[model samples]
Target: MSTDGSAESRPAIDSPERIELVHVGRTLQSLQHLRVVAASLIVLYHTELQITRLTDGIHQHSLGFGAAGTDLFFAIGGFVLVYTSHNRKDTLGAFLYRRFARIAPLYWLFTFLMLGILLVAPSYLLTTKGDFWHFLLSLVFIPYPHPVLGIDRPFLFPGWVLNHFAFFYLLFGSLLFLTSGKRVFAVSAVLCALVVLKALFRDQSHLLNFYGATVALDFVLGMIVAWIFLARNETPWIIAAVFLVGVSIFATGVLQNVSEGAERALFWGLADAALLFVCVSIEKQWGWPECRLLSKLGDASYSVFVSHLFALALVASILRGLRLFPTLGVPGARIVFLGAAWALGMVVYAAIERPLMRCIDRQRRPRMARMIVAKGP
Candidate 1:
C-alpha cells in the first residue's frame, strides 16, 4: 500500500499490492470522520466549563475529558501532515503558502469578528479586554498575554491552538527546506528536546511556557504512527481496539493515580494514538461504509471549533432573556445549550466558512495555474 500521496510513484503492482492499496485507502477514509468527533469533544468541554462558571461550579465535573480534545487534535495534526507530505515534492515556500492560505484567511476573519464583538458588546464576550498590539499579534498567530484573561491567549480563546500549529509548521517546513525531505529523525529529536525543555523550565514566563508545552510532543507521536503505518502497512482491528481500551483505562488512572501536565500528555497521547490506530485498522480490515453526517462534520470542523463559543454565547443570551434556565435547571439547560451550539456551528460552517474558503481557493487557483504553467512540462 502506498502511504505517500502519489500513487504513480509506486512501483509496478501485483495482485497483493492492489489488495493492500484498497485496504490503505479505506483506512484513510474512516479516519476522516474522527475529526468531527474531536471537534465535538472540544465544543462540549468549553460548553461545560463556561456553564460551570456561569452557574458557580454547581455542575462542574472533575473529569474534564473534553480538554483532551486538544491533545487528540495535536496527535491527528502530526499524523495527517506526515501522511500527506510523505512523497510530495513541493518547495517549502509553496507548502507554507498553501497552509497559510488554507488556515489564515478564515482565522483572520474570525479574529476580527471577535474583536468587533468585544468593541460592541464587551459584557457578552468572556474575554473582553483587548489591546491593539495584542490584537495584531493574535492575527499573526503569536502567543501574547490575552488582555482580559491574562493568559497566553488571544481574543479568540480557542485560537491558541494555532500558535502550536504555526510553530510545528515552521519547524517541519524548515527541516523540509533544509534537508529536502530527509532528516526526519532530526525533527523528532528537536520535538523531544522541546518537550524536555518544557518540563525542565516550568518556571518560564507564560508565553514561553505555552510554547514549550509537552502537548506538542503528541505531534511526534502522530508522526511515529504514520511511520509505523507506512512500514508495517496494517494491524488487526481487534488488537488495535484492545490496546486502545487498555491505554484508556490506564490513562483514566485505574491502575495508578495520574494528574495533568507531562503525565496527562503521556497518557492522552498514547490513547489518542491508539484511537487513530483502531479507526484506521477497522476500516482497512472491514471496509467501513461512508458516514455522511460525520464526514460533513469533519469537513466543517475548523469552522465549528472556532465559532462554537459565540454560538454558545448567543444561546446563553437568548436563554437569559427568556429566563428558561431556572425552569430547565442546570443539567437540562446544559443539554439544550450544547445542542443549540452544535446546530449553530453547523450553520456557521455551511453559510459563512464554506463560501469564504471557496472564494480563497478560487483566488489562489490563478496563481497556482500560472506557477504550474511557468514550470512547464
Candidate 2:
C-alpha cells in the first residue's frame, strides 16, 4: 500500500542531485510490482475466507496465510520512508505533512464510508460496528479495543495496519531533525528499546502491546534493507536466490499456520524484507521495462488495501442474493470476489485517490517552490 510519483523517469543512483532529492520522482517499478503482489495476497486470503463462509466450510482453503502480506507492506513502508527521505533536508513538519497528505485523506474518506455503512446498514458489515470513541480513535490512528470484538482493531478493521504505519511515521518524522545517517540508527534504537521493554515488563495495556509488538521489528528490517540499498549493490543472482529462499520459508510458515507474534515477525517479516530487498536491488542493478498494467495496479495498491473489505462484502452480498455461489462453487466464487475487489479498488484509485492526490500536490507545490527559492541555492 504505497504510492510513488512519476513512473516514466528513472534516476541514476549516483546522480549528483541524489542528496538534494527531497521528493521521490523516479518510480521504482519493482516496488510498484511488489505492492500489487502484496495487496493481491491479502485480497486472495480474504477471498478464501469469504468463500468458506459462503459455503459453510464445505469448501475451504488455506490462504489465511495471505495475512502475512501486512508484514510485507510494513517492510515496504519502512523502506520507502527511508529511501525517499534519506539525505534530504526535509524538516520534521514537512516530512510528517507529506506523509499525512499521502495517507490520511483517503483513509479518512474510507473510514467515514465504513462509519456510514455501520450506521445505516449495520447488517451489511460483517464484523465492525459503530462506536463513537472507537471511530474517533480510528480516524486519528489510535489503537483501541473494538466495541464488538474487544480486539485492538479500528472501525475499519484493515486500518489496524495503518495505526502501526502512523506510529512509524511519527517516529520517522521526529528523526528527520537528525542527519539522515543518524536518523536511521536513532529510530532503530528506539524501536529496539521498545521491544526490549515489552519483553521485560510484559505490559498488557493495549497501547503498549500494540506498539511493542515484534512486528514493529519488520520496519527495522526494511530500514536495514534501505541502508544496504543506498550503501552498495549486491550480486543480482545472489539476491534472486535469497528471494526464492524467502518465498519458500514464508510459504512453509504460512502452511504450518505460524501463529502471530515473534514467530510471524521472524518468518513473514524477514521473508518480506528479503523479497523487497531483491526487487529493489534487481531494479537498481538492471532496470525493468515498464508494465503499465502492473504499475497502475501497484499505484492503486493502497486504495485496494483500504477499500477491499467493502468490495469483498459487496461481492459476497450480491452473490448470496443471486444464489450464485452454489452454481459458481468455491473456486469460482473466490475468483469473482478477488477480481471484483481488485477492480473496485482500481476504480476507487482512478476516480477518487488520484484526483485527491493531484489536488493536494497542486496546493502544495507552489508553497514548496517558494520555500526552495527562499533557501537561495
Candidate 3:
C-alpha cells in the first residue's frame, strides 16, 4: 500500500512472482487483518465499559484487556510510517498532509457531532461538557483537561488517540528532510529522549506529561521492527513462534492488569510490536487467504475506532429504552452492541469517510498536476 493508505496492485499471493515481490514491496494482508482485530478489541472494551455503567457494576467479566488495542495501534502506526515511506521520495509537506488528511476529516465531523449532542441533549453524554474551550482545543488537536471529565479527553473521547497521532506525525514529518536512515534514528532518539526526560523530571505540565509517556516508545519499537523486517527474511515457523511468544506476553499483561505507565508500554507495547512484526513477516513469506469482509473492516478500522463510541451509546440507549437488556442478558446485549457498532462504523466509512477522502484527493490532484506542468518533465 502507498503512504496515503491506498492499496497498490499486487500479484496473486500463490504466484512465484508474488513471493519474489514480497521483498520488493507487497501489501501485507496480515496488517489489515490485525487492524480489524485492533479496532474490534477497542469496540469490545468500550462496550464492556458501557455495560458496566448501565448495570452499575453487575457485569462479571472484564474486557479491559482489549484496551491493549491502543498499544497495538501505536506499534502498527510506527511500523506503517516506516514501511510505507521506504524507498519513496515524499516531501515533508506531502507526508504531513497525507497523515492529516487521513485522520482529521472524520475526526472533525465527530467532534462537531459531539458538540451538537452536548448542546441539544447533554443528558445523552456521560461526562463530556458543552464547553467551548474544550471543543475548540479538540478541533486543533490540543490536549486540555475536559471541564466535566477532568481528564485530557476531547469532546469526542476517541479523539484522544488522534492527538497522540498528531504529535507523532509532527515529530516524524519534521525529519523528512533527512535521509531515511537518519529520519529513523532521529525519531527514535527524540522519542527516547522525551520518555527519559519525563521519567527523570516528572514534569506536571499537561502537554509535557502527556507527550512524555513511555507509550511513545511503542512507535520506536515499531520502527525497529520495520528495520528488522526490511533487513532479513525469516522462516514462517520462526515468525509464527515469535507471534506466539508475543501473544503469551500480551496475555500475561492482560491477566496481570498491567495497564499503565512503563509497565503497560513494556508489556503491551513490546508484545504488540512483536505481534505486528510477526504478522507482516509471516504474511510476506507465506500468503494469507483473501477474506474480503475482514479486509473491508480493516479499511474501515479508523472509522470504527473513532465512531464506535457514538454507535455504542446509541445502541445502549435503545437497548435500555426498550428494556431489552433484561431479556437479552449481558452476553446477548454485548453481541448486539458489538454487531451494531461494526455496522454503524462500516456505514460511516462508506457514507462519510470515503467521500471525504476522495474529495480531498480530488482537490490535491489538480494542484499536483499544475505543479508538475509548471516544473516541466
Candidate 4:
C-alpha cells in the first residue's frame, strides 16, 4: 500500500505506510473547486463598484475594502507553496524561474491588453491624465507619483494584487533558505510585531505601509499550518476553535475599526490568521469534496482572479449597450451580472489564459534548458 513513488515509478509495491493503491482524485478536485469559490468572492466584492456609482469619490470609493478575498489568496498561496516546495528538491534558481514563469508573463499580457483597451475606450480607463510614464513605472511595481491611483489605474482594478504578489514572491520565495522550524517562528514574530506596531505607532493605518511584510506574514501563517499538519499527520480541532473565536471577536465588534481607536484591526488580522488555520485543517480532516468541472475552473483560478475585474467592466459595457445599468440596481440584475462576469472570466481563462500559459511554459523551458546547457552539467 505504499503511496510514495516518483511520477516515473511503475509497478506499485506493498507497504504499511504507502497508500499508492489508493486514489485521492476526489480530494484534489474538491480543493480545486473551493479555490474557484474563493475567486468568486473576490469578484462579487468588485461588482459593487457599479452598484455604488460614485463618480466623484474615486479614492474614497476605491476597492480598499476588497482585501478579505485577497487575504484568502495569500493564505492559499502560502499553503500551496509550502506543500509544493516540500516536494521540490530542485535548486532555488530553478524554483524562482519556474514560479516567475507561472505568474509574470500572463500578468504582463493582460496588463498590456488592458492598456490597449484604455487607448480605444478611454471611458474605461481609470484616469484621463495620460500619465503614460507613471503607468509604465507601475508595470514594474513602482508606485507612480502625484496621482494616488496614477499609473496603477486600469480598466480592471485588481491589478494591484499582482503588485502585491510580486512582493510576495520576493519574500515567500526567500523562505526556502530557512529551516522549517525557523521559518514558522520568524513569520509568526513578524505578524505579531505588525499588530503591536499598528496599535502603538500607526494606530492601524493601511497595513500596506509594510504591505510586502504583512502579506508575507500571512503566507507564513499558512506555511506554519502546513508544517504542523505535515509533521503531525493530523490537524488539531483546537486550531479550528481558534478561528471560530476570531470570528466571534469580529462579530461582537471587539475588532471593528482601528483608525478611530477601535481594536478591530488587531482582531481582523487575528481572525484572518485563524481562517487560514481553519481552512487548512478542514481540508485535512474532511478532505476536498469532489467536482471535475469546478476543479478545472480552479486550475484556471489564477487567471480567473487576475482578469475578473476587467471582465466585470467588459460585461457591464455590453449590458450598458442594452441600457441595463440605469435600471439594473435590482438584486436579480446584480446577481446575474456577477454570475455572468464570473462565467465570462472562466471562459477567457479556458480559451485564452490556459493556452497563453502553455505558451509561456514552452518559452520558459527552452530558456531554462539554455541556461542549464550554458552551465555545462
Candidate 5:
C-alpha cells in the first residue's frame, strides 16, 4: 500500500560514461497496480477472519495465505525506496520528511478518529479496546500490547504494520547518510543480525521481538531486488526458478503444518522478490496499459489499509443488525464486506488523505523550486 509513483533519474550501473539516468515510469506503474492487489488481498484476509468470527465458525474455509500480502508489502517498500533513490540525491532529513509526510498524516487522522470512537462508544470497537498509553503508542507508530487482545497491536489493528514500517523508514533512512551503495548492505546486515540475535536470546519483549521477527527479512529481500534492478541484471530465469522452488517449499510447509520463522521468511521472501523481478521486467519490456480503476485503487490503497477496520466494523455491524450475514453466508458476505471496505477507503482517500497530501505538496513545491533556481542551471 506504499505508492511512490514518481519519476527519477539514475545512471545505469554499467559503463558509467555510456550510461545515462532516465525516468523508469513503467516499473513504477506496475508497482502501483501491485499495491492495489496487495491491499485488496489483505482486505479479503481480514474480511474472512471477521466474517468467520461473526458467524460463530459456521464459515469454514480459510484464507490463511492472504497474510502473504503483507510480506509482499514489506518487500515492495524496501524496493521502492532503493529503486527511487538509486540515482537521485536525497538527504536523510529530506527522505525521512517525505516518508513521514506520506504515511503519517492519513494515519494520524484515522488514529484520532478511532481514538474519538473509543472515547465516545467503546462498545463499537467490539473487543478491541486499549488504554490511553496504547492510544499514544499507536499515534507514534510504536509497538505495544493491546489491553484487550493481549497482542502487539493497537485499537486499530492494521496499524500494527505501520510500527514495522516506521522502524524500517527510520533505520533505512538514517543509513542513507552513508556513502553510495553502502546503506543497502549495512541495513541488510543490521536487520539480519538483529533477527538472529533475537532468535538466539528468545526475547519476546515488545520492540526487540517485533524487530527480530522473520517478517523484517522481507525488506531485505526487497533491497536485494533493488540492487538487482539498479544493476540491470538479466537473471530473470534464475530468479524465476528460485521463485518456483520457494513457492513449492512454502506450499508444502503450509500443507504439512510446518511453516514458521526463518522458513516462512525465506520461502515467502523468495517468491515475493521473484514476483517483483518478473513484474518489473515484463512492464519494462512490454509496458502496462493505463487503467483508471487500478490507478485510483492504487492511490487509495494506503487509505484503504489504514482505515478499512472502520469500514469493516461499520459493514459488519449493519449486516449483523439486519441479520443479513447468516443469510448471505460466508462467500456472499465476504464480497459485500470487501466491496464496502474498498468503497469506504476510496471515499476517505478522496475526502481527506488526497487533499492533505496535495496541500502539503503544494507548499513543498515552491520551496523546492526556489532551491533549484538558487542552485542555477
Candidate 6:
C-alpha cells in the first residue's frame, strides 16, 4: 500500500483491476515491497572504508552483497515492463514513449549532473584521453561504448546499473515480438550460458564492453517468470515451483558465497526471483491489508536506491569523528552505523529524491494538445 492509503505496485490511478487478489497479483505487489526493502538493505549492509593517508590505509571497502539489489532491480525492471504492458494494446510509438517517459528524464538529469561535476572537478575525470566518447556512448546505451573508459567512483558508479537496464529494455522488448510462441526456456538457457562463461573469464575491463553478458541470465530468468505465470495465469502449482527452487538455492549455499561472480549471479538472481514468485502466488490465494505507507515507500524506491549512496557518504562523514562505537570495535560500529545509514537514506529519499522524481516525471511526457477550436469571445 502507498502512504496515501492506496495500494502499491498496482499500475496507477487508472488501472484498478491491476490490483487483483489473485495469487500472482499478491506476489507481484509483495515482490514490489520486497524489492524496496532489499534495496534499503543494500545501503545498510555496505561499508565504505574511508581512505586516509596513513602509512597504509584501506583505500576501498566491499559493498557487501548489495549488488543483489542490482539483481532485484533488474528483475523488477523486467517484471514491471511486462506487468504494465502485458494486456495493453500499444502502438510502437506509444510503447517507446511510455518506456522513455518512465526512465529517461531522471536518468538524463543525473547524467548531466555527473557531467557538470566532471567538468567542474576535472580531477575526477579519467586520465585516459578517450573518456569523452565513453561518457557519450554510455548515455546512448548501445553495444559496448568502451572508448569512453569505465565508471569512476562517487560520480559514475551508479550509472553502470543504468547500462544494465538499458539493454534489459531492449532484451525484453525483442522478446515481446514473440507473442504467439513460447521460447522463454530457450531465451533463459542462452543467457544463463552467457553469464557463466563471462564469469569464468573473470575480467573487469571486459565489463566495460561485456558486463551485460554476465547479468543477462538474470533478466532472462525474469522473462521466464512472465512466461510461466502471466502468460498462463498458472497459480495452483506456483507454491510447488517456489518450494523446489527455494531448496536448490539454499542447498547450494548461494547467499553465503556472494563473493563469487557466477555464484552470486546465479544465487541472488534465482533467490530474489523464486521469492517473488512465491509471494505473488500466496497473494493470489489470499487478500492483504491496505498499507498505503508501504506502497509509497515502494513508489519512492528508485530514488532511495540512486540517492542512498550519497546518503551513506554523508552519514559516514558525520560519524567519522564521533567515535562512539569505535571503542566497541569495528564490527559493533558497523552494526550501529548500518541502522543509522538506513534512517538517513529514508530522510534523503523523502527530502530530495521523491521531489526530484516528481519534477522529472512532469517534465517528460507532455500531453498532446487537444484539438479545441478557439472559443468565440
lDDT (tens digit, per residue) of candidate 6 on 12-86? 331121222213333345755765666665664455343221103543444445566667666666555555555
Q: Relative to the true structure, how large is the alpha-carbon lDDT of every model? A: 0.68, 0.79, 0.78, 0.56, 0.74, 0.53
Model 1 lDDT tens row, 1-377: 45553433333322111211233333355555777777777777777665666566697454466666777888888876676666566567866765676567778888888878878987767556779878888888898887777778876787888888898888887776443225456677887887777778776766658877878887887777766665564656555665768476546742444434666566767777777766665655566678767766666677777888878887777777797777887667668776776687678767876777566556656777787789898
lDDT of 2 by residue, 1-377 (tens): 11243211222222111211223455577777888888988888778767777887776576656767888888888888888876655677777776787778989999888878778988877677767899999999999999889888898888889999999999999878887668889988988888887887776576877888888988998888998988898986789788898989887887788746667787888889888888888888888778988877887888899999888888988998999988997778778877987899889988988878777766776787788789799
State each candidate's clash count.
0, 0, 0, 10, 0, 15
Clash list (residue pairs), candidate 1: none
Instruction: Show the colliding residue pairs in model 4.
Output: 1-15, 1-18, 2-18, 2-20, 3-18, 3-19, 3-20, 208-211, 255-264, 256-264
lDDT against true structure, model 2: 0.79
- Please tell me which predicted candidate would have the highest TM-score against the true structure: 3
Q: Which candidate leads the pack in lDDT?
A: 2
lDDT of 4 by residue, 1-377 (tens): 21332211223212100111122221233336546766776776676665564222332333333445565666666665565555434456655665666666667777777778767876766644355675676567543342535333332346555665665565556666776566566655665676456546652344333442344455665667667755764446686577678678555443343221233234434455566566556666776555666756666677778777677777667766776755654454457656776687667776776676566556655676687689796
Give the TM-scores of the predictions, in the order they appear.
0.86, 0.90, 0.91, 0.74, 0.87, 0.71
Model 4, residue 58: distance off in Å is 15
Cα RMSD for predicted model 4: 6.6
On TM-score, the stronger of 2 and 4 is 2
Q: What is the lDDT of candidate 4?
A: 0.56
RMSD of 2: 4.6
Worst 10 residues of 4 by lDDT: 13-22
* True-structure Cα RMSD, model 6: 6.5
Residue 282 Cα positional deviation in candidate 5, in Å, after optimal superposition: 1.6
Question: Model 5, 178: alpha-carbon shift in Å?
Answer: 3.2
lDDT of 3 by residue, 250-346 (tens): 8898778775567778888888888888877776677777888887787788888888988898888898889888898888988998898889888
